[model samples]
Target: MSTDLLQARDLTIRGEGVTIAPFSCSLGPGDRLTLLGETGSGKSLIAQAIMGTLPKGLCAQGRLVIDGEAFDAADSTSRRALWGRRLALLPQEPWHALDPTMRAVSQVAESHRHVAGRDRRAAFQAAWSDLTELGLAEAGSKLPGELSGGMAQRVAFAAASAGGAPIVIADEPTKGLDAPRRDAVVELLARTPEAAGALLTITHDIDVARRLGGEVVILRQGQVVERGPAQQVLTDPQSEYGQRLLAAEPSRWPLPKPLGERQAPVISASGLAKTRGGRELFRDLSLTIVPGEIVGVVGPSGCGKSTLGDMLLGVTRADNGEIDRAQGHTLGFQKLYQDPPAAFSPHWRLSRLLDDLVRRHRLDRAAIPPLMARLGLDENLLGRRPGEISGGELQRFAILRVLLLEPCFLFADEPTSRLDPITQRQTLELLVELARERHCGVMLVSHDPALIERICDKRISLEATPSVAKRELDPVMA
Candidate 1:
């Protein structure tokens, strides 16, 4: 007799050395619930449990009701029939959700055709329309591998929601999006509830939850710390963790100290040009990075921010420009990926991978423990595989690995996008400190302009056209 579209009664999750205590919540028609928390705080796990997609070795318990049908949470397969018909999930990592071999439009069309019960032609048309609305008109024909991280995210969203499920779950839905695109995504999510459907969103961005303006549940270390209306909880959070999370926004962060003196340039490039998908991304770009300096990159999604970094690191060739690295430092250039799990072997434990790197490069084993402590990583996390740990932890681990080689230049591609505000602040502060200490030049990429403004000494702003500009802060500001 309950009118709720979905309900969880004392749902709990268990895994090796981890336990998400009993929690209960529900969503009715036109309802929205957001799980707000730090990385590794069980936000994604809760979403996985609801979607019946928890990774191996993790088990869920308690009762779940979906579309008036009751099922035991432990039997994940019991809800298979409801997938795409009554429930849909947009995973945090779009790469995992999208097929690498399939074109963006085709994947979305598949969902519309099969799950939404539309005809083939109608599905294809709908798919194209979806891509166009998401500002990906040209990306429809590109395979998942060809798209940028933000482009791939939009594709995945189109595919997941094409089914028209009454209940939707989105995890970190706006993680790597710029302000305009991020607002668009939020509008899309808001529309679901407006159309009399139910929505559940998981995110670490406080602004995202505030914009959604629904019920908010704060979790920490696998436990519910607080729950209330979004306006009340976000504006006047009672829990101590909630206040810290809100305070850690980039806008509230303290400005970093200016560099002491200009050092020799670590890398220099001139007249860089690149084109992708038959569109001119950027041309005639030039920049210089000095040791102990942080240069930030900001542009719309798919505007070639990552591509420019690759050009400088020699991972990708520029069509018409030349890159010059400091002499004798060719081996010292490194990169930290946007998705940390993609960079490591999922089957190997973190310790084994670190050991291999140390052995291969003749790095000092003693430096590992201190760096781990400084990064706020627990030693026990090293025992688990990359897929077993949270994204933020893996990213920190990636930084630790890169620092071990004593790199002179680093390309950090949205390194903190997956982290919570508190963790993001902490990680970036540590990265800046280490960059200054080791005199390493870091090119930081981020979707948030405020973040780049706070931490970067210089910034490169890319536009849709071939024009680009590199802004250098004054000595006092830098």
Candidate 2:
């Protein structure tokens, strides 16, 4: 008889400032289940609960059985023993699971040697093979710090499967990867356990859920609002919360109507070509954005979309291209970077940085509170540093800062990727509305086809380069 690998009965998880109400589920052999929800919706928390790795100040109640053994959240000794041998997790944040000082190869190799009891030399060889499978063989020697965000994520995933554990759990496995990498990761996980298909994924990306093809449990504010086959749940969620979430899917959202009679081009590029690491991302690409125009640059990961943003802002020089900037612009270009936490100084208080933007740009301080509230931010967070807040909160703050600048051109690179679904829609809409009010030209870079369709006036696609195969784009149009 097939036995359940992991089971959580009437699980309730809560932390200092968060709560996850009663939710229940089970994962057995050949079971492919995805726990789906937005950021802070307790998706990660549930995974941590099963692994007995809940964060400090957080507690879990009710029954959890792992591999036919009762699990204890605070039993450090057994937890270490169980990891990689019986249970392995790919944490959402790569840095959280990776050791900064250790070389990437050694760390992943440790999993093979320690958990699986492989010979020392054999473990090292197997580690390389694992990295190769993930398309990260060249990065094996590099430390986690040396890798990019997406590379680190891939490495962490490689480590998760190091011991050939029967049950694998990955949290937001596709978070930083581009479309090609995302699809590759999904394929690798789908073939997990030698095709037995015992994999559990926790993520907010609905498209990812559909691709994985399994049972889905839709979570909201820590509650199980709906559950069913992945296709049905994603395609036609019955509950109100489920309906709202699906409605907010970027593909389903309605695109804003055109801004009739666009003004003269605020920025124009001609013959733009950039090469990075001996690979051409896009060659001879040209685009122009008029005042109030929202031009979305769409492409798979590593397709030079962000590089194009740099070229437009005159930050990174294109190998062969010229960009014309409007003359005497009141405010120049400003960027909402892909990663908000990295953009701010760790040493600076949030309030101090915000204050500087307000004073420098002569922004109306009175409008700050309301804006922060709308973004679901707590004003008390202003006293803390960027490291003190979550990525979602920091992203909202980053957007608020750019709005204060009131720049003539806004380079928003996946600004809402970290936000929850509702907030994603609200934030993007607010950005476009503010841009229209200021007649700003926006260059939005993203891998989300739904988002590009909903907000962009002109869609510019960065064709696939040799480094990344598979053009996972919506219909190709100039």
Clashing pairs in 2: none
- Per-model C-alpha RMSD: 1.8, 4.0
Over 4 Å off in model 2, which ranges?
52-56, 74-78, 98-110, 113-124, 137-148, 193-198, 326-331, 344-365, 378-393, 466-478
Model 1 whole-model lDDT (C-alpha atoms): 0.89
Task: Give per-residue CA lDDT, model 2, range 10-67, as digits (tens).
Answer: 8887656667898787777778899876656778777777787775567888776777
Residue-wise lDDT of candidate 1 within 71-123, one digit each (tens)? Answer: 89999888888888899998788887898889999999999999999999999
Q: Give the per-residue Cα lDDT of candidate 2 at 105.
A: 89
lDDT of 1 at 278: 75
**Using alpha carbons, what is the TM-score of model 2?**
0.84
Candidate 1: give the clashing pairs: none
